[model samples]
Target: MANKDWKTFMIPYEQAVEELKVKLRAIRTEYRRKNDYSPIEFITGRVKEISSMLEKANKFEIPHDRLAMELEDIAGIRIMCQFVDDIETVVNILRSRQDMKILYEKDYITNVKPSGYRSYHMIIQYPVNMASGVVNIIAEIQIRTLAMNFWAVTEHSLNYKYKQSIPENIKSKLKEAAESAYQLDQTMLDIKDEIKDAQKLFEVKSAIVSSIMNDILYLMSLNKIQEASRFQSQLNKLIEYGDVSDLNQLHLLVRKEINRFR
Candidate 1:
């Protein structure tokens, strides 16, 4: 296809990536709103560049007319997790979703590549609405822990620098780094519950503090200066030494303080 034609052809894939990123990020927001720990750390997405796509097509002997059929990763979404166990949670979440249907899955975490590349990959068919009509397209979603993603990025950079002919010493170093990353993920999983509790406590404290400050400002806005000051003092005390780890506890305390003002 001509350059203009290729650009036009790529618009759908670009849309797919952008839409998928937003949808995936909403999952994280939902978890935070519920005061729960999310398995997904972050999400990123990209549509394959034309040059890179052409290169892969040639390498894989894909014909020009069959690029869409052969290139499963034309649209890519990456989901990063904090713990190794989180990867499974994310995968299960995707599997349970009805909006996107999974075409297949590759469990490279259980079957690591020889170059120490490890990630769980899912090929899903997503429907994208275009001006012409709704079209079903294949998008690849990759799930990996933070450590695993870090190692993968470093290794990818090295591979590009060496043109995929990395020297033996550098390859060995990459392998060692991958192993260290795996261990780090494992360690995080060991203290997962403790980490989760700490995170929840922090979220609760922040929410309560914010709500109290907002309420004080509202009082001041209504020219209730004395009431605002008194509430501010109470809020300061709570911030200084509040053992609140849940929303209900914070709400009860704040309610009592507000009742005193009344």
Candidate 2:
């Protein structure tokens, strides 16, 4: 009966989580539309389950009445990035937001936890406009690289399974894995410029392929079947020979073909 009541009380927090997730995802969409690099690879959020909340309250010896005031992470958001430096970019973006006030930050990345946990955690006070009135809720945001998230996720599962008493051997292995993930992130950062150039080439090639396909369809619709076939055949050869990568070069080729058809 108490758990049921707690679930009902958590409705606002659940709404907050969903709202924040949508907003963060929209930021990612904005970056892609501008053909810009986005530090956030993805966003995920969740409201704490009643049982988990209760467990945490009990662990902290919190009275029932103090639960709401003390529990900051009832609403949580996680942003995953591709590189460790990207985590700093994400933090800066959050800090610049006017909608939510950043209460404080915990830099676990610089000073890793004894358990080998590493992430950047921020506590923010977000206003959730209610029908009755505006209520400010505290939400915790954690940012991590893909590799750091992978290790944290695995470690979390093991902690749950062992109830925080993981075997020594397993713990050692996890520590090693965390170190390896850190090294991998560093290596990626070292070659980030090259990786970005390759990605830009891919996007350009994709755009050209899509434009060529549309042009082929337009020609076919105008009963220019022979012209369409010739254009498509040449396009296939160009793609097969790995010729279309630069946007300017693709535009030149497409312009010549388009002028011929028109």
Candidate 3:
């Protein structure tokens, strides 16, 4: 009974949120295609106020303004990225846009509010054209890494459920978790170069081995057993070095083993 009544009140504000999300998605898609950014991780939206609904009554009286936003996310969008650095690149793209007016800027990453919260947030006002009419919606953009998002979602759920009055000990634990996530972000960026190099080397070695084996089989098919056998030994010598560009030192050692194998 309460849920049904809440929906009637929440519907107009909810429509505003849904419309904002559609606009954000269109903007993001345009940027990605224009800039050649592919394999995007995630894009999501939320309208806030899970506990209550917004109605004409929810609209404030007096100097607060009646048509003004009261919900946390009068409109909201979350942009998730693979790399921590990607978050800034995303924020910058939006910042440069003329259509989106920045109402507020909060750098939770650098200036964490001591609530163990971390994200880059921008409160923006953009004119959204809806079937009903054109409305100016205040949208909040949260940019963060997937790891940060995971921690935040957990923290938010706990906060809402417990009314944000978590025990002191638990609050300390949440701070530790946030710090850990920060460390993990730094470490991943540091190791990314090495990881990419290793993956490339692994792929190159696999392709070379397959090519060598095919060559050896072709020699055998032509009845050149001696040639095929010698080439097979040479291929074995090459195998140990994998995809190494400088394999001369390893080549010396492998050649000795290759002769023995033959």
Candidate 4:
């Protein structure tokens, strides 16, 4: 028996991820720029694994001079979104692209895998021009929530540890744990707006504090208390009431501080 020449076709993992990222961004940016779509929300591509390679090799024999795609990814670019509604938005984005061929889709969020794993997967075929020639490769794109991904990571580690012979007790415990994780993901989604609001407050406060310190650096020098106090009225309100929505209020506070001091 002769050894198959898949290596010639198999791209280095780094280059494989990089090329796909570029390909995705190129088309997406063009679409948004041409159509004037605001708030670009989705990102793509991630590192691959050896298991992915073996799987592909076994699935399809490579013709001479062509590379094989092995898409074993552990951290696999799972997009952790804020809304249950956005999953379809991401899927539609992928479907609309002319450069990509939608191989298949499984909506595990609506119809979860029997093991409790929830995600949307598509075996997309996209063209990449390699040194050999133009080639199309299959990259499995999975859309999921941050909580879902976290739970999945923990579950995967346990599966590897137990070597698929998970003890009955542990299996039951894990099933409960997965349910808890699912509840957490749902809770997070339910409070997505609140989470975003809190995150914005944190970002805004950090920005203002840094800005105040920087501005006071020249004249105030090491006067920490005065500098902090200088923006006292504004800082007090922003940080104390972290959970805010009105961007206008924040903007006005910043403007007042700059006008008063500078």
Clashes of each: 0, 0, 0, 4
Off by over 4 Å in 1: 224-242, 245-262
Q: Which lDDT values do the candidates have, in the order given?
A: 0.87, 0.87, 0.68, 0.60
lDDT of 2 by residue, 181-218 (tens): 98999999999989888887778788888887887787
Q: Output the worst ten-in-a-row residue range by lDDT, candidate 3.
A: 55-64
lDDT of 1 by residue, 24-115 (tens): 99999999888778999999999999999999999999998998877999999999998888898999999999889999999999999998
Question: Which sequence of candidate numbers ranks them by TM-score, best first?
Answer: 2, 1, 4, 3
lDDT of 2 at 20: 95
Tens digit of lDDT per residue, candidate 3, span 123-232? Answer: 88767665677666676788888878988998988887887687788888988998898888888778867855665566556655665566567657667678678766
How much does candidate 4 score in TM-score?
A: 0.66
lDDT of 4 by residue, 98-184 (tens): 876877887888887656777778776656677777666666678776556666777778877987577888777867776887888
Least well predicted 10-residue stretch by lDDT in candidate 4: 67-76
TM-scores for all candidates?
0.88, 0.90, 0.61, 0.66
Which candidate comes out best when scored by TM-score? 2
Residue 67 shift from truth in candidate 4, angstroms: 9.0
